[model samples]
Target: MPALLDIERGFAAALRTGDCTMAAELIAPAGVSAGDAITIYRNTFVSGAVKALKLSHPAVERLTGAEFFDSAASAFVAASPPSSGCLDDYGAEFAGFLRLYEPLLDLPYVAGVARVDWAVNLALHADDAKPLDPGEFDVAARIPPERLVLVPHPSLSLLRLYYPGDVIWRAVLERDESALAALELRGGPFFVLVWRNADGVQVGRVSEAGFAFLSALCAGRTFGESFDAAPSPELPVLLAECLAAGRFTDFREI
Candidate 1:
């Protein structure tokens, strides 16, 4: 019998390269020839990976069309491959791949959209916890910059894009809504926000300042520092709205 590592390596190669002969030798066989059975494995592998990619990048798939996106996703899988044991993490780098992918160079915003999608997926699976009560902030006249930590919800994802991908995403996703109409892709360097709530996936368009503010908090910056990075007359109001919207579910004084 082939060693487990060798068999696994050969299996990956055969699946990616479509060289079924080697793959056949590794798996258990029944009446079917090794090559024939290997084909089953290959098909299963590709289908599973592709489906996950589609789910993770629905907006990209919508914009690019199913066939193009599938082929590109297949090529991406063959190249970088997945390093994680979790299938959920399989397309973590897909955004980076789309950025360098030749056919997608014209669709620069697609990659940013992919990033947002992946973040949403991660956030949905994020740890469950009660969100902070907005009234808690009223108890403190001022939070110490060093000791204060703003907790953004684990499911909240902020994305910056060179095009209005968020707007496009909304139209494609909410097509069934009565309010949805024909959408023309906006020419933009836009920001997007995605978070999970009681209603499932929730997406919103945000300003560059909002993106910067949330992003800084995510990176562990103090509220004061994050606010300083993107100061605005309405920041206090904006922050309150985000909290009210469940952008951050909880906080701790770290």
Candidate 2:
């Protein structure tokens, strides 16, 4: 008798690769053939994965159209199955897959779009935390500038893309033909900031300087160092905006 873990692995392998021989040996005889039973499991597994991908990357599906997106998603699922049981945690590598997918080579920006979509998905599901009070940094004031670390909100993320993916994604969400038509994809290597607030998730492009400051802080640079890294002279203004947006959850003295 095979160990339960071995049986589970065999079943997963059959679903993932469509080779049912090993898995079939473990199944008790029934009216349906072992191959037929395994086929049902395979279909269910693939369809569930495809649905999760579609949910996570809706803009990708809209851009590619249903048929093409399903084909591409199927290929991706076969190549990379979910490591975790949680469906929401799946498809992190899908943007990378789109980049290397031969059929999507002509649409170079699709991968960037997928990246933005994934970021939004992550923000929406991230753990909830209250924004730090404006005075929270005061404690750090007593600590030397070199040792203070600004901690980003658990749901905050920054994405830099070669295309205006956030704009494209918003247009898709709004279902506005005019907005879609007005988009000019030629101008950017856009820096987008994503964070979840009390209302909902927000996605917007940030200035190079703003992004620089935020990136430095996120990377654990000291408050003084992060301010110095800002590309624009308006570091104070940007810091205020970040606070208002609830991008930082707390600070720690390192």
Candidate 3:
């Protein structure tokens, strides 16, 4: 008799590759043949993974169409099965997969679109955090600038892409034909800010300087260092916008 670990390993391999020979040895014969049962499990696992990928990368599906998305997703699942049981954690490498997918080479921005979608999905599932009030940041202002580090909200993510992925994604999501028509595939070197709020996930474009500033803060750079990294005439305005948008959850003296 196979050990439980061996049985599980065989079952997983069969499900992942559609080859049930190893798993069949472990299964007790019943009404269904072991091979048939393994086939059923394989189909269920693949279908579930495909559905999860569609949800995680809706923009990619929108770009490729359901039929193409399903085909690509099947290949991806076969090559890289989910490591965790949680569906939400699945498809982390999908964007990278799309980058190398030969069928999608002509659509270079497809991978970038997938990346944006993944960011939004991640933001949706990020740990909940409260935004500090404008007054709260005042304390940090009083501290020695070199010792202060602005902490980003747990849900905040910065995405820098060379394609207009966010625009394409928004157009599809909003069902705006005109907006879709106006979008050019390589229309950007966009710096997008993604975060979740009371309403849901929000995505907005940010200037390069703003992106640098936020990224520095997130990396635990001191307030003075972060500001200096992206010093600009619009620095104050960008800071005000960050505060208004609740980008910072707190400030720490580090």
Instruction: Please rank every candidate by TM-score, starting with the best.
Output: 3, 2, 1
Question: lDDT per model, in order?
Answer: 0.76, 0.88, 0.87
A best-first ranking of the candidates according to their lDDT comes to 2, 3, 1
| TM-score of each model, in listed order | 0.84, 0.94, 0.95
lDDT of 3 by residue, 103-157 (tens): 9998888888898899999998889888878887777789998999888888888
lDDT of 2 by residue, 1-254 (tens): 78889989999889999999988999899999999999998999999999999999998888789899999999999999988899999999999999999998988889988998899889989998989877866676688877888888888889988888888888877787898899899987789999999879999778888788889999999988887786577777777787888988888888
- Clashing residue pairs in candidate 1 are 131-249, 132-249, 153-248
lDDT of 1 by residue, 1-254 (tens): 77889988987788778888767766676788877777788888888888888888887888789999999999887887667767777798898999999998886777876787787777667667566677876643265766677777778778777766666566666664433355345666777888876666677876778778888988888877888888877777778887777777655566
Give the Å error, residue 156, model 1: 1.1
Candidate 1 structure lDDT: 0.76
Candidate 1 vs candidate 3: which has greater lDDT?
A: 3
For model 2 the TM-score comes to 0.94
**Candidate 2 residue runs with Cα over 4 Å from true position:** 138-143
Better of 1 and 3 by TM-score: 3
> Candidate 3: misplaced stretches above 4 Å?
none
> Ten consecutive residues with minimal summed lDDT in candidate 3?
180-189
